[model samples]
Target chain A: MVDKSILLDNKKFTVGIFDDSDKLLHAVNTLKEKGVKIFDCYTPFPVHHLDHALGYHRTNLTIGAFLCGLLGCLSGFTLAYYMNVVDWPMIIGGKPQDISVFTSFIPVMFELTILFTAFGMVIMFFARTRMIHGIKEDLLSRRQTDDHMVLAIDNDQDQSLSNKDILELLKKEGAIEVNDSKEAFNTSLTSEEELTKILKSNKTSTKKTKKK
Target chain B: MYTADIRQPLVTGGKTYSDVTKDVCRPIENKPTPSWWLGFSIAVVLLLVLAGTLAWTVWEGIGTWNVNKSVMWGWDITNFEFWVGIGHAGTLISAILLLFRQKWRMAINRSAEAMTIFAVFCAAIFPLFHMGRVWLGYWPLPLPNAFGSLWVNFNSPLLWDVFAISTYLSVSLVFWYLGLIPDIATVRDRATTKARKFWYGFFAMGWNGSAKSWGRYEVVALILAGISTPLVLSVHTIVSMDFATSVIPGWHTTIFPPYFVAGAIFSGFGMVLTLLLIARHVMNYQDYITTEHLEAMTKVILLTGSIVGLAYITEFVIAAYSGYEYEQYAFANRMFGPYAWAYWTMMFCNLVAPQVFWSKWARTTPWFIFIISIIVNIGMWFERFVIIVTSLHRDFLPSSWVMYHATWVEVGIFLGTFGLFFTCFFMFAKFLPVINMAEVKTIIKDKE
Candidate 1:
């Protein structure tokens, strides 16, 4: 009964492809049409609307920052009040420990608010994105962090896929460079220096043409 | 479609990526020459003089400074205010300018941030060294100690300064360090030695230039820039309050906060320019720290200088219009009193001088701008001197009026602070990649 079922177990695989932002968008759209889910997109610089192309929703990081800021403000006020009024109240100047204390504590409160907001938002962001120390990540393109826009697609259907057809689609959509992740990683690990040399040679040839 | 390309020059004359790396890192990797050593030695000798003076002052007591009954806060306070004011520009350039999306800031922001840190460090020393009993400095902290002392006075502006400066230092460090991470990673990738690689690698936090990490880094940086912009403004505002909150003649004014802020950016940019002009030539980063960057910064200096000039005029007007004898006396004394020479010097350097930048030639020329920056710095120091000393010299009573001057010890310490600043800066230049390598690479790739 299960043999004829349309649903199949999800299998995770990382794919690396490079193109201009427009081409990447088109490839993403084509991938969406074929029911291929995008895992992530990596680029050296930000490409506008790329998140939307990958079907990513708005993140909660900002909301987290706001909440953390509120907490920071409360903590700052509470600490100042407790220390000045309740804990060890000593009237040095004519000013007393009352509402005026709030003004004095504003600097501390401001500092704490910014500190909490920044750290809290960043922590939430990293957690949501599954980025942690020493975690090995798939590289879509070496130049992605320099100039290229990379699309990392995860084909999860576990069905037999036409690799040649996918490469053709990528090429037709104006991909500057394309490579399968598994193949690239195997080549990278086995002969890392040779891989760098190949990249360097390719870069030089491109530079030579521009010189003309 | 691209017919213009055939007519246009194909190869732009600029250093390639490898050349860029080699040129920028030359000063760092190469050994110091005799000239470099000689310059460093002079700075060191000046630093030692400052140290000797500080030691003598501590041994003798706070009485070594020329602060008398009338003028309690003398040259020490003046220098403190001066250094702190100078420190403000760095933060303004790095944080505020970044938020405004000023692309020209990229050339000088790293060095400017470093200057801010060092200047703040120098400013911090004055308060502690002037405290006489430097060991008891921790009493300012809110924590409970063995001494039956209560919590810090939250009401005092001085205490507020302690909090503000410490917070500014910490946040600025984080902002600077976060910006340095990518560049440090670049250095790590280029390192040849195992030890150098390990340390740089450790600080680089295992950065692999992964797109996922870059995505996170960009978001965090944006958020930090957002937070730091307000924090920077608040810091200087709080610093200004150290004077503005006081009831003294020159000190008591609403115009002080913004005036101080403008002066800060003016001086800070001047310092940045001074450093970068030398660095660009010495380090061979003329392309990175381009003429366009200098022009943009020159515009900022001119704008801030005008604002400062307006503040000066407003201050005099406010004093005369207040109908208060002390305020009137303070303003008149600042212009036509014992410190008048210093006042005019400051006016000429900060207010009248920066007006030259209005001309295109002044803004575009690095050497001219560099000299102007030095003048602005001197003018800022004089501004602090005029404010602090001139006001205190003759206060409420005419009988208690007296002239005050900094002793040789005070001068040495002030010069020594420069030693501290430049020593750290020289070391920073030697060890770390002064430019944000990754950020620069991103800009370079944009041309592609």
Candidate 2:
């Protein structure tokens, strides 16, 4: 049997960041031409056709929801039937464990169907996204949930021949910012003072030039 | 191939993203003028009078109201039915419009749903108070125990109503809360204080704008909306059955269900318009609840009003054609009997007045719509009164027939419900984001 490990570490990635979606698309196409395996695209809101652009398959959440709903309906029917028919058989309005019992149970069944589907699909979603409770999140940009877009490419260290060639290619393909995982992780670990100083100087110059 | 644009804007003049937030949130963020407070205070006083009357009613018992042995269900039932009918418009605007993908609902749905929940609460009070022993109201539930209260009659429309109303209220609350979570999250992000942040954060359920969360939320909303659409329809249909199941002359009609549903939608839309018109102006959310939203609601009002008018005519026609002397007499009596003034007032308010919206000016002007909505509300209440009282006042037996009048106690509780509705609404407006900030933001990136 093949080993199925939940905690598998993938290789480090290089990402060419673009503020504009069109430039991001062009960079993605260039990476595809160079046979680079892209990891995933992170966007604040859903961008049209990004899944197709990234060659990701359609999600299986809906299939999971449908199966859960089917199970729910069956369970609801079985529960109602057992309660009404086998356990305590009482007739109301001349209707008993015939078709009317099933009909009467329809609303409950519908409610259960929805409940199961929702619960099932949500669990599947959390599982797929690796969002377990107490697990720290890896953030690319704080504004990724607000207004920024990031395209990440997965680069295997052993397979890659030249770092200079990949950087040149990304820069040539109109990347506003080029970054590797190692550099980003290092930059992210600095104390608040040093980080704030660097950010402040960059912002002051940008503001001054914009004003002029 | 040229495709016809299914995605055309509903209104000619469309509002921008910031405009929507500004328009809807205006009421909460800005302080109302002295005049607004003055009007609100007047409503408050009327509500106080209603409260006093209810206390008196409780003290005096069911006999305090002028409902006699013959007219056991009087103004209280009428008011219950009327308020419940008014409650329907909110769900119709929120759930039905959402299902139909009418974008204009975005402007009015929040206030409308609030109206629905509050109106249902007010409607519930009448039946409980009218029951004499309001404390033991839970005896109606279908729980079996050593206490030998018989299981609730599944066949009884009233029992069905308990299930229907409770279910509707619970589901509506869930739907409303689910819709509100994102906006609550927005508030959480904006909160300056630790206490406010904690409270809003708890309600927001650790939402991080993750695609997974959004996906789950969307699915939940779609499913809830699906459930609520039919649930809202079934609620009023079941309420209408309270009369339709009865063998009374005017009340026993097959047309009552759809007719009542239409009337409910009409009254509901009227209430929605009433709230949104004032809310937009008071809140300074001109951009969110715009002219186009008002127009869409006006169209719904006009459509439902016509359906109700048709029902009115159909009832008269059916009574005449059936050759049932009692039914004909009841219909004739409503138009030309002791309560002729009330009947005519209802007709003029519900039927004739709504026709003014055929003109663009009547639909577009908020003040005009507001006045008309109030009239429609009055008309709907009278419609209930005319149906319940006139039908019961003169039944098959001539000797037992009598005149029924709502004593001051009955009148007080009815007015008090307005206090109940508005007070709850005012509080809701003051606290929560009256407009859904998240849903509005989703449409902000529309290419159109």
Candidate 3:
């Protein structure tokens, strides 16, 4: 029941498409209590406190930003000190170029700190999220990025809850549409310059099995 | 999930999530309208004028302009300061407002931040071309050079500006592009053509709207905003220091930092109003942009205008109170001297024009706000011109004083920058989503 041509492995998912974020949030809470090993949830925009419902840990991107910012600060200071003092020091406007005159370095220091922190944090974000240019998108539904909030549950992984049981739970929790799909998600992305081929060649088509 | 009862909906007409994407991406998906083509053509023509004038300046050397020995920095530095100040409002809206959790900014921040990036590009052109030897632009960097391994002066505010402006531009780009990814992904999903899908999907970077990605996205956005808030304030402060650190009687005032920053925000809002007023009407973004957004912007224009007005009065008072004859004469010359017309024009346009916003009707009216925005832009330009020229023309030695008038080349180059700015903006509007669709979706009132 899997599209072997596109997916890295054969795994079936019971996908639930909800129209409202509130309903999706509620369903995630209830499904977790029912011992459903939900894979992930997708939404058009960030829903308030929905991450808590999914039991997702708070992202440590702030820690990454701080570490990068600290690196930037030191680099800024070193660049200024080495150039102005240790390498070649010239007195301009009668102000001596020395460690005592650290105030003059403040502007460059501030700028470098910001420059590095922004770039570094963004790089960390892209790498951690595995987001980059020229990667094929593994989408459950075309409307997932538009209006629909989707919850993808790996029926193979969750021995506690059957596929039918999860689909029933999703509909009871206010999902507008339910589907038992095998070809929706792929763990391994095609590292391709073949973006043009995706429209004509890819075999995965998101077919909705039932409407609630 | 619910907005406060008293707070007006940021996105009007009860837009749905899909509606937000549809409304914003329509222009990009369809053929360019006649209006878009018309604006683009005009901008391109003006851009040609800039190219011609800059070519003349470079080929003919610095003598092409009418800047005299006494008035060394004429329109070049004035325009540089003006555009830089223009850029501040974008960051203020995007970074500062985001930090304050002002949701109204979500509708406007995307365009405002785009303005900031384009405005900086325009600002950078002035200083870079003003150097005359544009090929040697890399000389500003603190690199070991052929001239005896000499490094740039750390004490010089000019050098500080080189570091500040480049850093500002790069950081602003990073911030803006990060905000665009999710919205670009929305456009990617809706794209029908293979070419459109490839390009949009390329930039969208495989964004699957994962809740985990969004959580990290929030954290990164917050930290960037935190750093950018101070970065925005520091940029204008450094620009002001270009004048304040100098010993020239009029330019050497301690209040220049706060005053210049206020004027930057004032002029920036003015420009934002000018652009958005035209965009909302032509693009049919009234439901998203709304009169409420216009009014909130006018309030900012009003507040910053007052601060700038106060700075003007304080400068004059401080100059008069100081016992130094040169300082007193500088203030008197600006008021009653040869350039009195320019000075009074600044005072009236900046100080008096914005006082009309005290009325709620004036604040909400788009046409009236547009006019005031234009007037604010003009006044701020004059503010820079007055500060640069009046002080330099009649410094300590009266014998060396000479009047400066901008040559046609100077005027054309200044006008050409508008071409550069508009051309970039029009292309941005056509190719990319002008509104932040993702953020707007979050604020859409869910019709349960």
lDDT (CA) for every model shown? Answer: 0.71, 0.70, 0.87
Candidate 3 residues A1-212, lDDT tens each?
12222222565668899988888988998988888877888888888888888888998877888888888888888988998899988886787789998998989888888988899999999989888787766777677787889998876674577778778988999988899874464223322343334333222211110110
In what order do the candidates fall by DockQ, top score first?
Answer: 3, 1, 2
What would the per-residue lDDT of candidate 1 be over residues B1-448, giving only the tens digit for each residue? 1123333211123544444444445555457656567667777777788789889988999888888988887888878877877777777877787788765566577888888898899899889987898888787877876867467766677877887788788777877877776566555544545565556656654444544455556667777788878877777788889889999999999998888888877877878888888887766567788777778889988999999988998999999999998999899989998889988998898889999999999999988998998998898888888888898999898899999988888888999988888887877887887876555543443331
Q: Which 10-residue window of candidate 1 chain A scores lowest in summed lDDT?
A: A1-10
Alpha-carbon runs more than 4 Å astray in model 2: A1-212, B1-50, B445-448
The TM-score ranking, best first, is 3, 1, 2
Which 10-residue window of candidate 1 chain B scores lowest in summed lDDT?
B1-10
Relative to the real complex, the DockQ score for model 2 comes to 0.11
Question: RMSD for each model, in Å, please?
Answer: 6.3, 7.0, 5.0
Clashing pairs in model 3, backbone N/Cα/C closer than 3 A:
none
Expressed as tens digits, the lDDT of each residue in A1-212 for candidate 1 is: 01111111232334545645556767878876776666566554445556666665555567787899899888777767777877787676665777766788887777778777766776675566543443322333444333456665555434234666666666777777665443222112224564456346545644553364
TM-score of each: 0.85, 0.77, 0.94
Q: Considering summed lDDT, which 10 consecutive residues are worst modelled in model 3 chain B? A: B439-448
lDDT of 2 by residue, B95-208 (tens): 787898766676567778888889999999999998887777787665553555335444457866776777677666666776776565545443434465456656655444
Q: After superposition, how far is residue A36 of candidate 3 from its true place, in Å?
A: 1.5
What's the C-alpha lDDT at position B133 in model 2? Answer: 79
Docking class of 1: incorrect
